[model samples]
Target: MSTESSAATTLTTADLTLVRALQREPRATWTRVGAVVGTDATTAARRWERLHKAGLAWLTAYVTPPTWTVGYVDLACTPDRLLAVGEEVCRWPPVFSVERTTSDHQLFLGIAARCYHAMDTLVTKRLGVIPGVRSVRMAVATHIHREGGGWTVGPDQHEPSRTSLPLPQFWQDGSVRTIVDALGTDGRLSSAELARRCGVGESVVRRVLARLLRNGELAFRCDLAHVAAGWPVIAGYRLDVPADVLDRVAAAVAALPETRLSAAVVGRGNLVVSTWLRNPADTTGYEARLLRTAPGVRVLDRAVTLTMPKRMGRLLDQAGRAVGYQQILPAGGHPVPGG
Candidate 1:
């Protein structure tokens, strides 16, 4: 067996049960988590702390798309400086996820911005001018059928219910921003801790958090190293579809068990999908399954992720574990130093 698979086996079934319990309720109390996992609160908390400290699992939050403009960028960089270019871009707050992929466009980025104009400026003026960047192709997500935040740790979990809440004026409140930044780094922070960080009363923190969650303004997710989770391969597919069937195609693709992200975009390819697989060979079978399920989808391009340096502002190591954290504010709101 490969080293990754061997490392994966080290996670006991009990450890995964704890992860799944959190996947269902990201901010549940240790008492609650222990109840669901059939262990005591102290043991559950201790085990989670160990996994988190090792960068094997984590919890984080993000402002869901449609609240801000969501876009993807495919960048072709000089082969010699490809890793350098990815490192530079990954530090920016707007670029939430950066992947080194097996394609002519060596880097793929997921970006969020306040508006299309801001996204354009960030790309054309900021990203496009990077020293080693040879070319840029940006696609605006017209619909977010599924996103990484919606994915769960194991099989048999239903998709989280989604509620479309209007953007509230208080979204820009200082306390709210503080809460979001703190939770984005550690979603499991207690209300008292979050209140302390936001310099507000616990009651105030509770009220605001309830409002945000009830309104669907903030999203929390439980994430773990994919390799340790035993799904070692990530494949992305670009698809062309007639506009008439775009939504239908997106729904069909997003419903697949392996899908991590499925979105309709306004670009060369109208549909883009990313999926987890047991092995590289699964990519072929996945495409064939998509063809049978979503006949309207015509696969245009594909790329397999080689390394994910960052995801949703959390820096990851080669094994896809969260090694460091960066706050991802609304795209363009936080300025990068020296930009």
Candidate 2:
């Protein structure tokens, strides 16, 4: 499809509702989602298929690395080579997110490694040598108050579940990895499909998936291109919050309508936030609102996103459509070919 067509595409309200339903219940059946979204199962499934085919929306599975430390790194690169550097960096196994931002530091990278030492080596030994890179700043995320997995395109329509499922034991067996690998590209795959890909029986695939979800070993995310969602402007913030009020402030900011990511990191600006804005001009006003609601939260730095080359496993074009995806293995883990 043409870039113009992709960028011009806009999601209808019903489409947004479907996306939100999946965000709430990633593994829920179409029948359940349809009931919640005021539609039929067939209609719900069709809408999702349309969104997925258009590259405007997608669902993927993630297995968090138990031994890895995640860091958000900012790279200042030569202006002329910024885009080149971004495209190259996004493909690195350790880097999962790459964005061009409006700041002295032109590129923002999210890196995951087995430990602090690996992260250090990646920054000083690997990233430092990249041509055109001028400087680098790294912040280890101390706590994740809210991840992108928690953000939804629309308001919550379903009531909170009163009962909690029992957490299952964390499993790192090859079978578990195979299951995760099968679902990495599409989290909504059916039991039959998962079984076919993993070379297991349907019942076994079903059991493994259930265990993974119940134990929090796997996370599913429903993502859409911001431009197609009517929120064309993306902004990032670094806030200096007092230690005593950090949790409270993080929670408050996370609850905002525009927040996509909010976390507490170890750095000069301890609180990092990413938000979607309907208009680029509204950035100052949004900051004002944040200040009003979150008292004593100082804005350390802010950057407006120019382009996102990659998000999660999806490689996006300049217009923000998922043209392809790169397989992301767990940190310090080997790839399970064709799993």
Each prediction's RMSD to truth: 3.3, 3.4
lDDT of 2: 0.78
Residue pairs clashing in model 2 are none
For residues 46-161, write the lDDT of model 1, one tens digit per residue: 99999888788888876666677889999999988898899999888888889999978999999888788899999999999999999999899888888776776566433743
For lDDT, the strongest prediction is 1
lDDT of 2 by residue, 94-152 (tens): 78788899978888887777578878888998888899999999899876666677777
Which regions of candidate 2 fall more than 4 Å away from where they truly are? 64-67, 156-171, 334-339
Single out the weakest 10-residue window by summed lDDT for candidate 2: 157-166
Candidate 2: residue 327 Cα off by (Å): 2.2
Clashes of each: 0, 0
